[model samples]
Target chain A: MSVIKTFGKYRNLLGELVKKDIKLKYRNSYLGVIWTMLEPLLTMLVLTLVFSELLGKGTKDFPVYILTGRLLFSFYSNGTKAALKAVRNNAGMIKKVYVPKYMYPLASVLSGYVIFLISLVVLAVVAVVRGVYPTLQLFWIVVPLAQILLLTLGSGMLLSTMAVFFRDIEYLWGVALMLLMYTCAIFYKIDSVITGTNGWIFKYNPLYAIIVNFRNAVFGQAPDFQSMFYATAFGAVLMLFGTFVFYKQQDKFILYL
Target chain B: MSEMSAVTVQDLGVKFHLSEQKVDNLKEYVIRILKHQMRYKEFWALREVSFDIKKGERVAILGLNGAGKSTLLKVIAGVLKATEGKVTRSGVLVPLLELGAGFDQQYTGAENIYLYGAMLGYPKAFLREKFDEIVAFSELGEFIDVPVKNYSSGMRARLGFSIATLVEPEILILDEVLSVGDVKFRKKSENRIKEMFRQETTVLFVSHNLAQVRSLCTRALWLEKGRLVEDGPVEVVTEHFEKATTK
Candidate 1:
């Protein structure tokens, strides 16, 4: 089935799952929606402290750098991790109900977007406090960043589905992301890694471009257009191919699960 | 049986993969994969299970516990895939396979109308119109806004059954879920089932209650150890099921 049509088919179920995921995040917490801010806020503070005070890096507006890293990481980690279990976690629903199975993964991706909205508010406030002016160019950051989401979600669907068959992938993904943190220039300066051997790794890694794009757009700098182009094109293909794999393998999911 | 076949299954089968020990983490999974130590065991939850039912053909699947009756219905409902053979369902096959499997415990009963309504194949708009009706049926008036996990078993059953039976599926599959509710709620559920049955939905009902089976089903398929032991008029098949279990 075409990706567009399949999504078009499970639209209602997709929306419902997104609602459920969002509700679940704040469900039992006494502070409710406040916890959403607290995660990135606390993480940002700790990361700023380490990189500025401990590492002695040339840290100007440490909160800005920390928040930037956190926002992207939140979107990627939270999105990918949630989507990775989309099929296996909903086994009962999959076994009992006949939804377009790919809806489960897509919902996970969409749920991440919903949380990103929360993180966006927090990031904007931090940026304003740190004296970062809004660039009209920064608004354009949304385009490439959205592509990054597509790439992660599309690939995450395939990965999560396959993870059921090969259980080691989920664990492997965690370590891989840790490696990615260094390459994406999440904590450190992007220019420092833009040379020679480090340059080769950053140029090739899809997330490197995504982090650069976010820094440029949200933090008011220019992103590497070549990396963004590669990320966008690759993301489109992955969404198509990923949904296709999910469609083909969805029938066997209940049995395997 | 009515003239229109709403549910059909031919030579349907199921299999499972079994491992030597419990698989807890990545290390165990890697070892299992590397050693080729995972055993593929065909449990045959349903072996060559074939049946057909026209619209409004109330049928009961009678069997001992673990006789693969629920699996058969699930296959027909498009929930479980047949390892072999095919199942052609003419219309919406809502398998209330187990009570409240679709509801998220964290969501409110009101929220679950949309959630479970989606599961039963009804759109949000359609459920919205009948939201009040479902709530009234659940008898969870004040608690509709509260989390479902906090609800009593009976409350959960009411909520589950109400959402399940809200929309009429062309093929409805029930698997011993209604029996768990309180007597009053079960009576309510039975009435709702009877209403949908009267309206000519092909019903694949699975339960251990012989009287309910005889009263509700025009046909009966008796399954034993994943094999069909009898398929005929309810009187004959059910009598065989009773005798086999008693013996």
Candidate 2:
């Protein structure tokens, strides 16, 4: 009952913020929402074409593999990066008017989620065209998707809070994300590069864990339950930490911002 | 005291830390911070200030520049956290610290009404029902469809004032936003605000215009250098404030 009441009160505010964010992004552009889908599809096409000979040899249905990893990585990266600017960009409103500050980051992340959802349409189309037929296990995609969503929200909140105080966290995070891209195994199979004890690194990389399981579901194969569980746990912990840091530091934001 | 008072502030203080050397970007800030080059000085904007507003009281805050008047209102509005002390309030409060603070310049005036209304916590359904009323009140007719960036300053202020005052909140905090629009529109806004006064809405207003303050408010609090100097009837406090500042 309390949860429902709280949601009832803030739901409209949240919806309005998200609407404003989405509209603002696509405003004044002719292509508008089409660009959200087009950009990733084009990226998948180019990467698949360029790297198919070099990196695609070890992976089956290489374009789908690259697209899946690329889409999820871009979603997480873009959401948190936008969130880094959320608090500072709204400094005008924050200084003059009062609303829940976290709403800015929440809306930013949710808007990126909207773009990510649009790009998923491209992913589905590619998977089907590549002859990777769907199965009942494809419903299992929801679990890893949920994990990514949680992780994105958590990262957004954490980055936004620190970005407010340091101003440098954004630049630092940019470099970190680029490093993350190579480690996430978007271009090649983990088995091709690492073996034995060294394989634990890829297993522990949360994105690799989620992406591998996601590919398994799409291919009608059973998921790696242990990897799936580890990824979920990793996302859950980060989300909790992000929420805790954001709330604790929010009151001081007016001073720093 | 407890039953009739709408707001109570006890020894409220707000301190802002001003760093002398500015680094707008994070890269420089990180480098400076790592080298222990970051330095900040504490500036107490409001120091141990206290006040109370009774239910249905229209009180004006009078002060010179840098006297912590806006800081006091901001603290009460929950925009700024108090460095020390507490604020207690009993009713739904709305603070118009800066008119159209969140309006998107790229959006049409019509779209901004919904955006502004939503920022003030009005649902879209409520705004949709009052859409005609707000546009008519703003007197922006055909121009409402154009982007807000093209509108004159007065027109933008009119749109903001119209949407904000459309809903009657229990307590209104006005930070010199009423002195907006042309003389004709100012008169119209004065009349609209008068309606709220008739309804006995508790108001905390900040303004330098003595005539407006005396006309609209019953009591006044004069702040000097972040400290409360006097609290009395509006006429008496304004008279004192005038002579002291002018001398």
Candidate 3:
């Protein structure tokens, strides 16, 4: 009921913001929103070709494995990257108007999620063509997907807050995302690369946990509940921390921005 | 949402710390922090300023540039945080601090109307009902569908003014916005503001134009170097400010 009340208050503003973001991304481009599908599809194809012989030795469904991990990571990266610029990009509006500060980051994350959801259609088609048929367990995909969304939202808020005060966050976050992508086990199996004491690195990566569970659900297996719990708990904690920091710091943002 | 006073300010102050060296990014900030190279000056933009506007009163803020006129409006509009003291508002407030604050250059005038309205917290349904009126008043006609980047500044101001004034707000905060556009639109907007005054809307306006302030507001507040210098009838304060400045 409270959620509904909040949504009722901001739905129009949020809708307009999301629409502006999506439209701006595709504006004047020939392909427009079709680029969302093409981008991932091409990346999946290239990675599948380049690494199939090299890293696909142990994995039964290499393309699906890579696609699943890549999409989720892309989802997270895009949301946070956009959010890092959200406050700075709207400095003009923030200085003049009094809308909730969270709306800018919220719109950025939602727009990325919208494109990520659309790209899933391409993932589904490619998986079926590669003989990884849809299974009943696919219905449970929402669990990890929801976790990824929360993580993205939390990450976005934190980044937006920092980015307003420190302009370097934009570039620093790019480097961080690259490291995150490599560590997320997108192109390799965890057992092959993560060995000995370093095993906890992959095991503790909240994104890795979410991606692995998402991969399981896609492979027609019930998701690993422990990983799901870990990722959800991680995302929930970040969400709380992010909200707290964002609200506390937002009032001072105009001064810094 | 109180009824007694539209806005109440007490001992408000805003201090900005102006750093000597610019920290352009996080790397520089971290380096400076680690090296203990950070230094800044405390610049007080507003100091011990206090004022109150009762419901249905039209008040104008007059001062020279950097007199904290815009700073005062921003603090009252809730866009800027006060470093000390407080401001309280009881009614719905709409601020026209800057024309086209959220307008996108690539977006059509019509699209910007919706976007700007949404930014102001109005739902699309409300904008839809007033969409035609906004367009007609702006006289933007076929240009409404054209990207705002191509429009002149006056056209953009027209669109912004139209949307902000579409619905009468309980409290209207205007900061040098009425002087926008050409003479005809200026007169039109001045008349529209007069209509709002007739409707008994509380108005807190900031302007350097003495004639406009004298004609539009019954009371005036004067600021000098971040301090409130005078607050009284419009004629008295404006006359005193004019005499002081000319001397």
RMSD for each of the candidates:
2.8, 2.0, 2.0
DockQ head-to-head 1 vs 2, winner: 2
Q: If chain B of candidate 2 is superposed on the true chain B, what is its TM-score?
A: 0.95
Off by over 4 Å in 1: A1-9, A53-56, A59-63, A166-168, A193-195, A219-223, B1-3, B20-26
**Candidate 1 chain A worst ten-residue window by lDDT:** A1-10
Model 3 chain B TM at 0.96
If you assessed candidate 2 against the hidden native complex, which CAPRI class would it receive?
Answer: medium
Off by over 4 Å in 3: A1-7, A53-60, B1-3
All candidates in order of lDDT, best leading: 3, 2, 1
Share of true Cα-Cα contacts across chains kept by each model: 0.65, 0.57, 0.81
Per-residue lDDT of model 2, residues A83-201, tens digit only: 98999999888887777787889988998898888888998888888878889999999988888888888888899998887777888899999988988899777777886878767
Candidate 3 lDDT by residue in tens digits, B1-247? 3467888899999999889876767788888989999999899999999887889988999889999999999989888999999899986788887888779888999999999998887889999998999999999999999999999999988999998888889999998898889899899998898898898899998888899899899999999899999999999999999999889
lDDT of 3 by residue, A20-98 (tens): 9899899989999999999988888788877876555634478888889999999999899998899899998899987
* lDDT (C-alpha) at residue B38 in model 2: 87
What lDDT score goes with residue B144 in model 3?
Answer: 100
Runs off by more than 4 Å, candidate 2: A1-7, A53-60, A195-197, B23-38
